[model samples]
Target chain A: MISYLLRRGSRVVRIILFISFCNAVLAEVEIYGEASYENRYFVEEGLFGQDKSHSSFTLSPEFYFESEDQKTSFTFKPKIRRDSVDNERNLFDIQDFSLVKVQDSYETRIGIRRDFWGVTETVHRVDIINQTDQVESFDGEDKLGQPMINLSLEREWGTLDLYVLIGFRERTFAGEKGRLRLPFPIDRNSAQYESSAENLRTDFAIRWSQYYQDLELALSHFSGTSREPEFKAALKNNTNLIIPYYEVIDQTGLEVLYIVGGLAFKLEAISRSGQGDRFSAATAGFEYTQVGILSSSLDLGWLFEFNHDDRYKDSPIALGARLTFNDLYDSQILSGVIRNEETGETNVFVEASRRVRNCCRLSFESVYFNEGTNSNSVQKTFEYLKQDDFARFEFIYYLGN
Target chain B: MRKLFKHFLFVSLFIFLNFTNADDFDRGLEIALATDKNFSGFGDSQTNLKMLLKNRKGFVTERKMKMKLLEVPNDGDKSLIVFDSPRDVRGVAVLSYAHKVGSDEQWLYLPALKRVKRVASKNRTGPFLGSEFSLEDLSFQEIEKYTYKYLRDEDLEGKGCYVIKRIPLDPYSGYTKQIVWIDKTDSVILQIHHYDRKSFHLKTQIFKGYKKYLNKFWRPNEIHMINHQTNKTTTLFFEEMTFNTGLSEKDFTQNSLKRSK
Candidate 1:
């Protein structure tokens, strides 16, 4: 790992030198980032041997440089985290390190970066480029930087993006001491891969997106190692441990969004092969907002989504609401509930945040899970997390720009 | 002969009143068109903005952002605003495509999530960055968005001004009408009195320290907005305003929003 970091360090040095050379010709550089502290408290004891609480601190710094002509730019962002209880929760990753050149109709970017795709608020079935940084957040909103060469073209029809992804990063998992974990820990070091090239495999993706009137649509296809992994049981240290098995797969995705007045309709669907059998999944939802509700400055938004996965027999529906207080502090709250129709399992989540003074923000989040009353029903891996209900608070302070 | 003379007087008086009203309407629209035309050839502009939001208790909060605008020939202008401070919102950007009629199009880019979300434009009455200025107040102004009537002539800050009353065309607009003061010499806006839906005096905006750019375009260095009802005020200061930086449509796309700093 040290050798690998050294190799990456050398490349960063070269990029800085190039930027310094352009500095003489009017290139500008900006430095900014954030430091955050988090405290988590669990309402229930873990099913396994785990701590009832955890504390973590994170630092993420960003450096950006742009040319005077606005045609060339470079960005570097590195993040580090230290956890008090769970060692596996500790993280060190470069979130973004990329250089881009923009032309009249085309743009090219190279190096590591993060990319997101999808419109629905509940599930992002079409966002397949970056691997999930699960240790950072189980909600799957956080992602590790993907190293790639991206080419984007702007045409009359739409915007076309092509990506050539190099190498693969394994998904992080919780340790035995982690609260939000399966019955057994995942032995990441012994992970299995279907591809002979293993983590060295290269991936390719293409997407074409466009906005027509009030409708926005995108079609994408990906051929690479699947970011989602299947699990197998293996014996480790006199105990059975879960071993993740990566698979090579091809995926085709579709995204649609239609906006009318204060309402938006969204749909994201995907079909994938090489994971057991060819299957499809979809999430369709709508968000309706009422601005200045009740003659007040607060805006209220309602969201509803239905999720279906072919591999899983159970279907789930999600309902959510977002409230924005257009006050001086920019306070907002989002709460949601997802329930399975067949098993009656439910998950509830809430997040509220507001800006503190000038450079700081404070947020509170809580998540709860309830299992079906039927004990004879099929036990899913997520059943282990039923007792992991927790609430967390985070305070973030941003650095100067 | 007396009855016939009285009927003739009535007919002449009606015609004269109709003609004067038509003239007033035409004159108000002509002035609005002239002001829009005067600023048409700027092509593009870029500026840094700093806002000081002061509450009724004299407490203050500051916000900083950068603005870029590209002129569209027949349609409304396109603009991009990127926040720089209140450091928590740094790198957040909003891209907008203003239209002459109907609702405008807006998209918000969240830097941390790398997500570009389409925003509903109907919420134009919401405060911008928690400041006294609403989203509509900062949006591009199009002559078609309002109906105008010539109120009178007035003197503002020692400058000859044309006072006009204009009502918003959007049903969701928070204001019922606005009284505007435009400089007669340069067609620059000097001040405005905004009235709420109840026709109550709501706010007053004063533009100060105007500077001419490219020997043609008039730009304001500072804009002071005072909320009469809430006793809150927001002052916007513009720095290093530049024009004709050669920005094209490509610079305002969703792809560019993610790249903005």
Candidate 2:
């Protein structure tokens, strides 16, 4: 299977090279590559019933090749990552091969990659995602096998930029089945019982930006449906589970005042359909950043989210701050609090990171879950997590160019 | 008889003025070339240079530099310059021809991985060592790179000088035009103003503290360039300069790049 995949990859590379050569005949060609390595540690508590820590290392490499003529250009880029943790490893790959043709007043490009869309910057970024051979589930026991195709279009007229996107996916499941396979039989024929599923999603967004200015305003809406068999089976068990659902996510935001010696600000708001549904959440946030003495910079941000459901209502607030010294060293601190009225459960968390150098960095994080009672304020009992209670460290180094 | 005599005088005066202007232009070009030749002799046969760079924001960084110059006797007045600076750079060399068909050929060696990479001539305008000086700035350009015009006589730093304007013939050049003040007495360039390709004022380079060598060469011990847009400046200081150290062409080849001391 690996050989077959390699053969397919080579064919794609050959096609890219041929196109690059043709383009180079008319203009100059430049190629470059970069590699980076990262080590991360994770510690989680409360949900899984135990406090466990795991360390992992990941290496990522990206290659870019471009050919440009007087009026036209083509660029091809491929990014690959190898991630390993505790004697297990996997690969993550993403490629963007685009041909851009420019005219006097218009430019167009066709490629398989992420699409930047919408006023909220999230309403219309639907793109094809390949899930086959992808490691799924925390235990790495289940694999998601499927390939998805996504289409998107965007245009700018006057001060408004508009975008739309549609995505379709087909899924198949693979794994060793136990004797009491609740969903299906535990045999090869049962594996054959797996069928292809289709999903359709759409998003619309509008953005207004000023010419030669930093301020921009955008609003967007997204709605989608999932008809995968696995989800359908789960819904069959509980009729309350809805499969063909629609969501109306509205977001409006602004980015203001970007200059060398000035401060900048960004604000965003998100509103969804019904409370407690799959995508029913409302959020508002703003960030401020400025550069100061000796080329040092600082940023601060705050966000608040509200969710309304049949059983309870939830409100969450988060605050973050970052300081950068020169371009090499930086430090960040973040804190968040989530409160549910019905369940009386409040989760609070804090995280921070500091860069030691260009090649190394350190991070610290902690979380405290408090169960509050509405009846008593002074005599309220709560549970909390501490530093020795739950935290991790990470370091990164870039190796080659 | 009187009318003919008067006409002859008028014609003679016009011819004299034109001849003098042409002579002034030729003299200016000669002075510029002579000044450049004298400055090129200030460097050692092979030497290393180090500098501390400070940005406008007060960030400081260190850079180590090495330069080697070779003169070709049999290859039609050719010269080679090799430079190695900070940032894993090794074996970066430039081959210049007093008369090449198009432009000079340059190659850079990456010491970290032990590889020699060729640089395209079209990128001559790119910065060298992250400074205002470009690769093209170091190469010897034939008279064709610019069309020199004598502007007028001027006094610079208590020295009699001829002010000349040079307009680039090649569109790819970084500068649209350059104005140079050349000292007539010592045949040395005192100062230069480099304009952008679009004719916008860009930067000024000032040469000072000249040290006479061998009683024949006048070399500037210091050169400074102030960028107008960025409000930043870079200064190059020459130390331990020597001439006639017997640099040969064999020291400039691709094979010699790796073997350099």
Highest TM-score model number: 1
lDDT per residue, candidate 1, B82-180, as tens digits? 999999899999999998877788889999889998887776787788888998899998999998888899998799999988889988787999999
Question: Which regions of candidate 2 deviate over 4 angstroms?
Answer: A1-46, A49-51, A70-91, A115-197, A200-214, A221-266, A270-282, A289-312, A327-390, B1-261
lDDT of 1 by residue, A1-401 (tens): 24433644565456456545644564356777787878889997789868788877777767788888889999888888777778888888999899999987899999999999889988899999999989777578999999999999988899999999998888989888888888889988888899999988999999999987678899999999999999999997898989999999999999999988778999999999999889999999899988778767788999999999998868889999999998889999999999886776888999999999888999999999888675556545358888899999999989664
lDDT of 1 at B100: 89
Worst 10 residues of 2 chain A by lDDT: A119-128
Best by lDDT: 1
Candidate 2 at A172: error in angstroms? Answer: 15
- What tier of docking accuracy does candidate 2 attain? incorrect
Cα DockQ of the candidate 1 complex = 0.67
lDDT measured at residue A66 in model 2 versus the true structure, 0 to 100: 40
Q: In model 1 chain A, where is the ten-residue run with the lowest total lDDT?
A: A1-10
